[model samples]
Target: MSGLADQGMLDLGPESLEYRMIGPRPDQAPTLVMLHEGLGCVGMWGDFPDRLAAATGCGVFVYSRKGYGKSSKATLPRPLHYMHDEARESLPRLLDAIGFQRGILVGHSDGASIAAIYAGSHQDHRVRGLVLIAPHFICEDVTAESIAQAHDAYDNGDLRARLQKYHADVDNAFRGWADVWLGNDFRQWDISEELAYIRVPILIVQGEDDQYGTVRQIEIAQEECYCPVDVALLPGVKHNPAREAPEVTLRHVSDFVTRILQGHEAAASAA
Candidate 1:
């Protein structure tokens, strides 16, 4: 693979993150910047980014955060406000580094929260929309319990071995996510306020049977986001909707992207 369909390390001074570009580069077309789940890395996304790019005819950019995949190790005992800092500090640098011209922020789980915060905090006109999959806007009992179970699995079961295939530092990747959500300080971790300030449209794709979060998450987006908030709650599905049910998830995301981009194009022509 060469040209736009290549993988490389992106240097951001403090960190050198791993990333993949699918289909067109950001300069050539609208882009889809995918943010992975809590225990997810660029590699864990598998070929979903490729499928998305093919379906939408947009550039797809996916990257591992500092601690996940082959990226740099995270600072030990990650700060309680790590997600906030990521949205406010790290994400902006990444967008600027990539020369993100116009695109939708496609995020899953923890990635979805960061995308919400970024969209709310920055009025970057280049960001046209958001496609949030299995996003959690607020803490819940189910979330804590699920995370605790995940930790147990990692320690006592084959979960660690499974994750090792993707992360260079598996412990760092799991610890950074597990410690935060399972920590007492995370109980009130809510980004509902951030959703309110988002200026663009949002498509919240969730699973009805998601083990990590509840329907309240979707409700939170509906209540807090002032902009148009579309939803797709898939029956008999789980937390990882895109991977668990690619056909449905991809259709929702692609249609959302197409609709929003077309609207933006029309608006631009009129302006």
Candidate 2:
């Protein structure tokens, strides 16, 4: 709930991205970066990152991409290349400015997709790995239906009011995200081709009952990626696995990263 420091800013020339950094453990490996969902902000993560940092003893960076949370609002209609722009341009700049050499990305929903794109694309191999929760690849009928329902809930239901507690500029956040998703040009939004370039180890987590996306999304990602990828489908869970199944999510992430870290040590010993 702290301001300014709890929510920091990253300069991106004309645009400044909003972010929060916690868990300054100096000795930890592969700093954990928490990437929020499409309509999420630091507040919206709801202490999950903090709890995760404590559990893993790693540095944590939680940030809202431009036009969301307390970050700079988009002045023009977001181009169809929004996610691509974030992954190819803005995310690298943010990490460079923050001086993160290597880190494990943990992202949910849209954030997860963006993280995957970045890890898959980075030439320097700075992204050690990824933990994706309910990520999207290609736009699907199920995604469209869920977004339509979200638009309705935002306009008529109490979703707007509920979302306000998490975002400072709630209207801007909701409208910016909703307008783009429902826009005609966005119907073809897909990242499958972009994701094919990813070669780092990945952990994909999804809910059996997720209303927002189909299992095919994760399945496609696992099948297409040219790297080690693991999938977990939580039973009876909804879209937000971090909230609905925190311990389960944490354990999966912790164990996967632990195994990777151990593998790194074993390789070092062999060498």
Candidate 3:
């Protein structure tokens, strides 16, 4: 495992990843390995990571996966199970390489789905809990419709220009995510079974009026997960909770992490 102070590009075999680390390292404190949305990169997270680190006193490791941000370009026409591929393959390497000890997998949107897959697919006791913001467990009709609209926006609106600021190759970042989800085959995409296998607790924060998905996503997690499930359905909020309701998101995430990991720290010290 590499040192937490390690900066610049992360070596992940054929493709290196761009990353930013904040606050204490893993050895000093529990870490929060943040996974961005399908179209998001390390830059898009902005100052949220900084606030989270200050609030929780934990390190925050944010990175852009392949095909997004400044990272290497992904091959075109990505496989239907691209999220699965990332969960089982790339994510594990990232955690081990960074010397991740104990912490939660904090994810937003697609990042949340990937986190669910990784936790359920393995028995990693180090992953103490999960903080999922706008996670999708199954593909909904609304999801497809919203993605179709996004295609139009990307082509015609200022969305492309806005995205270009954060992504090195905007089309690759957008198309890699948009194409797979828009495919007819993706309609049947579901990862609910993975939830049942997750042994750690979970905290799901979703927008009540999310255009991309409905509360059914939350229902799936509630129905399938055996671990303790906490839900925060924010009223008048949209897909991106952190952006739309930063303070609320910060409070929920920081409190949950403190309750889980900080409490654990106290108990361990007592023992």
Candidate 4:
């Protein structure tokens, strides 16, 4: 049942935020929730989720936000509170709607920020662990510069077409992210405060060659998290660590999730 799609709706104010689910074993084992990047969707994730799920024997849950993939397109402009709202309001609603009480979150870029915010804010929830691939904790000059380059590549280069292979509506997904980040208001966006509240173990991964973020971003996350934070820098890897170094990423993810769960079980037994 690879790539099988399902629909889920979460109530966010007066509007119903729709999401699309992909991959098999959505409810099986140590369920791994795959959150896409700012310009990503279920299709954009390619076969990574399926392969990871198979390798780890974990149920994989993937969902496209209101504006991306087969889910409902966003009509309103993205506000400064968008990411915060997603982490605080939309995520919990979606999880509760789907009955996901506990699971590991695999997040990238914007999705990674959302994961950090959620893990920090929801003190009572059961987030077994987190795997942050190319996550960011704060706004930096380097991030803005890379995003500017990405804008040029998207408009002047063939990057948009290359991305079309992964997105059904590539332009919508691409511009939605680009415009939001490059906007005047978005320059103030930062999530470091949210990271301080997270008490769960986290695996922060980044590629040394990643143009969008620097080592400082991962280091900030390590400092903020209340629990153990394992940092891995993949050599010769870029912003898309999972795509560029699947084997290495998979091994780390599998080992981290298993060890965390085992440690929890041991503590429970002792108690």
Per lDDT, the best of the predicted structures is 3
TM-score of 4: 0.88
* Residue 244 lDDT in candidate 2: 95
lDDT of 2 by residue, 1-271 (tens): 1122545677779678777777763234456778888899877888788887777766788888777877888654667777777888988887777777566888999899888788767764666788999998877778778988999999899999898877767878877777787788777887787667886788999999998888998878867888888998999998999999999988888887677656766876999
How far out, in Å, is residue 161 in model 1? Answer: 0.2
lDDT of 4 at 252: 88
Candidate 3 lDDT over 180-243, as tens digits, reads 9998999989999899999998999999999999999999999999999999999999999998
Kindly report which residue pairs in candidate 4 clash with one another.
none
Compute each candidate's TM-score over C-alphas.
Answer: 0.97, 0.92, 0.97, 0.88
Q: How high a TM-score does candidate 3 get?
A: 0.97
lDDT of 1 at 82: 89
What lDDT does candidate 2 reach at residue 96? Answer: 70
Local lDDT at 2 for model 3 = 38
How many clashes show up per model?
0, 1, 0, 0
Task: Count clashing pairs, candidate 4.
Answer: 0
Candidate 3: where is the Cα deviation over 4 Å?
A: none
The Cα local distance difference test for each model comes to: 0.92, 0.79, 0.93, 0.77
> What's the residue-level lDDT of 172 in candidate 1?
95
